[model samples]
Structures are given as C-alpha cells and as structure tokens.
Target: MDHDETGCQAAPEGPILCINNCGFFGSAATMNMCSKCHKDMMLKQDQAKLAASIVNGSSSSNEHESVAAAVEVQVTSVEPKSVSVEPSFSFGFGSGESSEAKPKEGPNRCTSCNKRVGLTGFNCRCGNLFCAVHRYSDKHGCPFDYRTAARDAIAKANPVVKAEKLDKI
Candidate 1:
C-alpha cells in the first residue's frame, strides 16, 4: 500500500491518486498512495512529458496523426505570403482514397524493408508503404506537429472522408 505525506496509507475512499502525475488513462491512487511521501500519487516523467506535450498542442509518440498534421503546418508556415501581410491559418484536409478503389498499378512495395504496408499511412517522400516498425515515427520520430497530426487524423477519419470511384479513369 502507498502512503501520503503523513506516512498514512492513501485513503481508498477519496479520489484515487493517479500513479503518475501525467496519467491519461487512470491513477495509481487506485492501488495505494506514495510509500515514501504518503501523499497523493503523481504522474511519472514519461506520462507527464506526454501529457505536457499534448497540452502544449504538440504531437506525442502514441499519436501518429498529430505528428503528420504538425508537419503539414510547419511546412506551410515557412512559406511567405506575397499578397497578404496579416497572419492566417488554413484548414485544408487531404484527399482520400476509396475503399473500393483499386490501385491502377501494382502494390507499392517499400524499397527499404520490402514490407507490404498497403495504402494506409504511405509516406510519399520515401516511397515506402512500411509497417509501423519501419515508418517515420519509429525511425525519425513523429514528424507532424502533435496538434496538427492529431487534428488531421481525427479529421481524416471523421465523416468528411467520402468514398469515390476511380472507374472514370
């Protein structure tokens, strides 16, 4: 059992203290209070760092979409506007691929690891349809800004994505 500042075991009756100060799922209080401090449990560093990054509107290791969006935003921000002097933010979403849609060519094999990543999360830059193990997140870390990647993923997965047919081609 964990104890708080007073050396008394954390009370099970009150709100259980989160095991880590930055827990997103639950708290350590459910188990017990701090053994040393005997106080409410706090989030651990890894969890705290993740939570802080999220709060700051940045991308986290767990959220890949956030990383992608952050990247797009960063890419756009660096370009200077010739006509407008005022700051502006745009929310343009990505084009979607239909489930029924078939690739006109052949399955895109990753040149690096040769894994069949399918069309999902394909990195246009490297021409790789790699599994998560070979993707940028695992390699270069989440490239997108947490906020942008997260928002983009959410937006992409939401109702906005309409399935289109490529039969016209």
Candidate 2:
C-alpha cells in the first residue's frame, strides 16, 4: 500500500524483522541480524578474542622479554662506526683489470640463428630461445612429449566415473 523513498512498494505483509529482536529490518547478510546488532555482536566477539590473547600472552611474555633483552645487548655491543674512503681513478684503457667483459651469447639473442630477437623471442619447452620462425616444437625438435602431457591433462579433467554395483535381493 505504501512505497519507500526509492519508489518501490513495501512488502505486502511487513518488513522482515531482525532475528536479534532489535525492532529493525533484517539484512540478508550478517546472518539476518540488523546492522546495529551485527556491529555490536562483532565488537563483543573482537573484545573477547583480544582478552583471550592477552591471557595467553601473559604466560610467554617473560620468555619474549628475555630474548629481546639479549638481542638489544648484542646490538649495542656490535655498533658499527662510520667509515669514509676516497675513490681511486684509473686513466688508462685496456688496463688488464678487465672491468667489463663481453659474453658470447645473451638472452636477447635467438639460439637458432643467433639473431637479436629482443622482446619478440619465445622460450620453447626445449630449453632454448627461438625467434618467430623457429618458435614451434617441430621447428626446434623439442624433446618434451606434448602427446603425453595432453593425455594426462585430458584424463585429469575428465575423471573415470564408475557406478557402484548393487546386489539384487
């Protein structure tokens, strides 16, 4: 007969009452309890859990404090002092120090043709990087058994279901 602010007709019987008997409309969520009652219940539960934790923690507090004290003493005794060092400069090229070395092969290079594939390179199951041309298993002669893997996946997805045998009276 009456409509709410959203212009939807109110329930013919009545608004659903809260299971907590709080005289408020029940929310399907929060297990049919009103928002206020649900919030209060949650707060009470949290306080109870906190009290239990405090009661349990009191027993182990002394052990933790002793370990913390030991750690603090060790940290204080081994305090590191600041040290300063001047940088040494070398003005010679090819100084036999070998600061940088060039690698024969890099990840960006394709293993098939040694081409610089960069981000376009594909890592095959054969444990080698290949360009678009040789990315397929057939192209690189990949040793991994794809047929066995496919069969296992199919078997796992479609499990064998056997009906239970029933004895006739």
Candidate 3:
C-alpha cells in the first residue's frame, strides 16, 4: 500500500504499472517509469482530444463527434547501442575523389574500374571519364542534373492527362 508523491498507490514491486487507478500491467514496461507519471500523460492526451473536439464543433457528448484526438503511448523504452561501421561500396583503391570537379584524369582510367580506357571510352555527363564497359550514365553511376530534363519530357508527353491544352493551337 505504498502511495507515491501524487498520492497514487505505488505499484507492487516487480511489475509494470500504468498511471491510472485501473493499473494497466505490463511486463515489458516496468523498468523505467513508475505508475504516477504514466497517468498524467494519459490525462493530457485525453484533454487534448476533448479540446480538439470542441474546436471542430463536434459536441463531445453527442455519441458521434467528428473530432478525435488519438494518442499512442509506448511504455517500454529501448536504448540504442552505438557502433562504428564503414560503407561497403569502397573498391579498395583508396577513398575515391575528394572533389566534384573532374580532375585532369588524363583520359585513361575508367572510374568504375581502374582499367585503361583505350579506344572504347565514354565521358559521362557527371564529367567523369569511363571505359566502354561502364560508359553509360547508369553504368558509371552518373550524378548529374540530367534527371530533371527527362522527368519534364515525360510529363509533357503524358497521354493519361486528358485535360492537357496546347498553347500553340
């Protein structure tokens, strides 16, 4: 029969207890919060719901008011663990480029592969140089401003938009 500072009966030891007199019990939630604070939080949630209903012109007692305040309470809190990790995309050749500006790469090495791009080579719009095997934008992972043009072109030609009007006509 131990009552907390709020005059609420403290939950019996070794049990998760909710804030209200109803004493919501849970095994997963007992580690952090005692019952009293949980009750106050629930009360604030209910009050918010009531205020929302009033503002929406839906009488709280009218059996079906359109306004509703939904509050979700999670009792059990999880602690996140910290760990260091490295990205797997590293090709083991030193951490790529520090600058976006395509250096005077001498038109030799394919960015995707360190192979010598001889006669068959392509320079992607991303300004990087690559061999025929990784020439296309996708093959060499081209990060450029070209996507917006393609997206705009598709929208302009969208046949499903029946309401389209041509200004030229």
Candidate 4:
C-alpha cells in the first residue's frame, strides 16, 4: 500500500509471484517460473538429458545426428516465414477476367467516348463503363429497362398479403 521513493508502487504479495523467487511474474505453462528462469531450466534439462545419453553409451552416432537435425528443424520452424506478394489490379466491371489477365484498352478509358476518365469512370447497370458526362442512363442511352427492373424489385420486396375469407358463423 506504500509508494517507494521513485514514486512507483511496490507489487503486493500474492500467489502470482514467481515460484523461482526471481521477483518476476510467473507463467502457468512454465510451472509458475518466470520466462528467464523457465528458459534456463529448459536448457539445463536438455543438457542433463544429453549428458545422461552420452554416459549410457547406448545411443549411436546416427541417433545423435538425428536428434541434432530435429533440434535444427525446430529452430528453423520457429522463425517467421517470408511471403511473396504480387500486385493485383481489379476493376469490378470487367468480363470476369483473372487477376493476372491484362485489360485490352486499360480500365481508365470510358466505353462511350473512349476518353481517359481515370479513377472517375462510372459503372452503369448495362455493364458499360462511362465518364462523368455519360454516367446517367439517358446520357449513355442505356437499354436496360429501368421501370421494369424497379417494378420487379418492388414486387419481390413486398409480397401480397390477402385476408382469409370467413364463412357464415
């Protein structure tokens, strides 16, 4: 409950303290030992195992080599893997082309006037790309039936609800 001279509060006594008494927080995976102490313990265990194997003289040179190879594999597996990423550009209005496929006239050109619209190209419902001027249905003379599409959409969204006819009670 008291603050030290450095203006930092001291850690209260609890079961969370490291069992190794190293004045650090304990981890459940490391048998309640701090990370540094856990690593040291692991190294000591590995060394003891190696020593015991050597003293027994039962393990062959081939077995030792295999163990070393396994350890090397573990070390390599722990390292982060390198990933290669290639640049992919996709315009949603294209003819379902793959990422690797290149466009014939590039995506920047407007289909109506063939003008360079760049990022300002508008996508029409008729599957044609257009510039700002020809973005509207009337401007591009779009053949996709707007009124029919709207009526169909509305019908689909709002289904008919009729009251059940009752017979004479």
Q: Pick the candidate with the highest lDDT.
A: 4
Any runs in candidate 2 off by more than 4 Å, and if so which? 1-107
User: Between which residue pairs do clashes occur in model 2?
Assistant: none
* C-alpha TM-scores of all predictions: 0.19, 0.36, 0.26, 0.38
> Between prediction 2 and prediction 3, which has the larger lDDT?
2
Off by over 4 Å in 4: 1-105
Q: Native-vs-model 1 lDDT?
A: 0.50
Model 1, 1-169: lDDT tens digits are 4456568864356555445544333436444433433332233444455446655876656575644443222233334554323222222345563324355976666545676666654573434455666666456454446677678888888856568877875
Please give, for residues 1-169, the per-residue lDDT of candidate 2 as tens digits. Answer: 4466669955437567789897898766777788999987997785465445444765277755543332222122332674443222222234465533466765587777888898999998768889998899888788889999899999999999999999999
Candidate 4 lDDT over 9-88, as tens digits, reads 56546657688798998866788888999988987786567556655866788967744433322122332575443322
Candidate closer to the true structure by TM-score (higher is better), 1 or 3: 3
Model 3 worst lDDT window (10 residues) = 85-94
Candidate order, TM-score descending: 4, 2, 3, 1
Please write out the lDDT profile of model 3 over residues 1-169, one tens digit for every residue: 4456569765567765543435565433643445566655676676666556555856745433223212222335444774443211111224554323455746478878988886676777788778878887777777886879789888889856467777995
> What is the lDDT, from 0 to 100, of the residue 56 in candidate 2?
72
